[model samples]
Target: MEFAKPLPNYLVTRYHGWKATSYQENKGWYRRLATEGQRPRAMVISCCDSRVHVTSIFGADQGEFFIHRNIANLVPPYQPDGDHHGTSATVEYAVTALQVSHLIVLGHSQCGGVQGCIDMCKGHAPQLEEKTSFVGRWMDILKPKYQLVQDIEDEEQQARQLERQSVVASLENLMTFPFVDEKVRDGSLSLHGLWTDIGEGGLECYDPKLELFTKV
Candidate 1:
């Protein structure tokens, strides 16, 4: 618990420095966004990783994206009390509350969560049971995708392929939400998959035809 003091010190110094300029100039914008209303047109389901910041990468200000971040940006299939319900709640809010037109499931390169999923599937990590850690249970959502990408000969290519496949899986899981399914069927909602390689600054879009993430 003593280590927790470092977080407060970090926030008081590092966070203050980052927010000082923005808060001085954009105070009104922040107040309005916090008090009035939020009408974000898109909902982005992304990783909780600090490096894969969707808003910063997309140049979106506050109230632009109804954001939800979880391990590996994975959305588990709809099931009652399945312990992976955040994705469902976020999708519901986006479709029913905010009525967002676009739902983006963003994946990225060198994802530790996705790598955990891969390792679990390969029997290198502990088995998924009731006592498994949250990450273990959460990353279970990407197990199938990890298995599908297992045959690649190149290690780097395989990691990229695993991330891409997880994106596709999460997109499918998006449709499991009743509201999302109804809207997609009625031509009101669209789901997109994006893979961002932070080191290379490359963003790719998932191609349905080739079943791959092609550079955008």
Candidate 2:
């Protein structure tokens, strides 16, 4: 393929720094990981937001978590049709192949994707509603949850509520996968939902019994 542009110099510089410092300092660890392969304990599904760093939040090391990012941190319901499904494929590999013990859906406040979903559902984003809009089609997974927050009179509050709802929706959707369901039933896997406050740096974990998110 023809090149649109060369790699950015800043990113190249950062890569060089990491190669010299992090890679050199952890050469043995990196070598072991490369030789033994990854045995990650958890799979975290989070938004593509640049602010959300899964490893930084958990203080995790390399190969500790199998992370996947997508808009709104939403998981679509299982559809067995033979077609492209990135999130589903990752979940399958994690559950069946990797046998990850925990699967966490991480949502965050001030999520642009969640806001976009709210806008698209409210008829404010015509561009997203178009058939060709991949983001629009992907976000349709969270559209139903919008009804849960529509009655909130405060717009910002409603958007935040919907952001948390994205986590709940994803957790529910995760159970729809047969492999995930089987593993959970067999006591081999667990599911979790979490939401983060970007500005305050607060983390909340969802309690299924109370159907609420409490600070962690």
Candidate 3:
């Protein structure tokens, strides 16, 4: 039952290199973090895309941010049906357990997940329409928001709009959780939406009041 495969050699080599250099340099910091446990100030929900490095973008260190990555960075509405809910569990732990002051939904340009949602909604992706497609079901969370950007004539513009909308959609879903809502109402937690440009290195923050993303 245990025979399968081993980790790739490249990963093992990199781990050894880190253990020799970065790990040794920050050994004390890592030990302290291990003993004290994580008390991250903020929790960032972002896409699983490898290019979206939240830590590098924010220049953060270990134990500074509680980060969760998933396809499209989506948060489904609260449903206490006694089912497995990974994102919901993460949010609950971050807000109610860790008491993180900030909860950020980070979106980015050229997001494949958002583009898949657009394609599925436009009836262009038949494979995604299949009920057996896990990705299709996951992208369903953002399917409704496609209507907002459907009118844009340019494909690039429409994709960009939907990418930003994904962040807003996640933020909206986060509030549906009772614990998250309670903390927000009590001024103990704050929600934020951010969209970044991978090629241009541009960052924008959403303003709930202005109803738009502004450059930071």
Q: Per-residue alpha-carbon lDDT of model 3 for 125-187, expressed as tens digits?
A: 999989999999999999999989999999999999999999999999998999999999999
The 0-to-1 C-alpha lDDT of every candidate, in the order given, reads 0.84, 0.95, 0.95
Badly placed stretches (over 4 Å) of model 3 are none
Candidate 2 residue lDDT tens string, 1-216: 686888899999999999999999999999999999999999999999999998999999999999999999999999989999999999999998999999999999999999999999889999999999999998899999999999998999999999999999999998899989998999999999999998899999999999999999
**Each candidate: RMSD to true structure?**
2.6, 0.9, 0.9
Residue 78 in candidate 1, Cα distance off native in Å: 1.2
- The worst-scoring run of ten residues by lDDT in candidate 3 lies at 1-10
Q: What TM-score would each prediction reach against the true structure?
A: 0.89, 0.98, 0.98
User: How accurate locally is residue 201 in candidate 3, as Cα lDDT from 0 to 100?
Assistant: 94
List where candidate 1 sits over 4 angstroms from the true fold.
1-7, 14-20, 81-84, 127-130
**Error of model 2, residue 10, in angstroms:** 1.2
For candidate 2, the TM-score is 0.98
Give model 1 RMSD, 1 decimal. 2.6
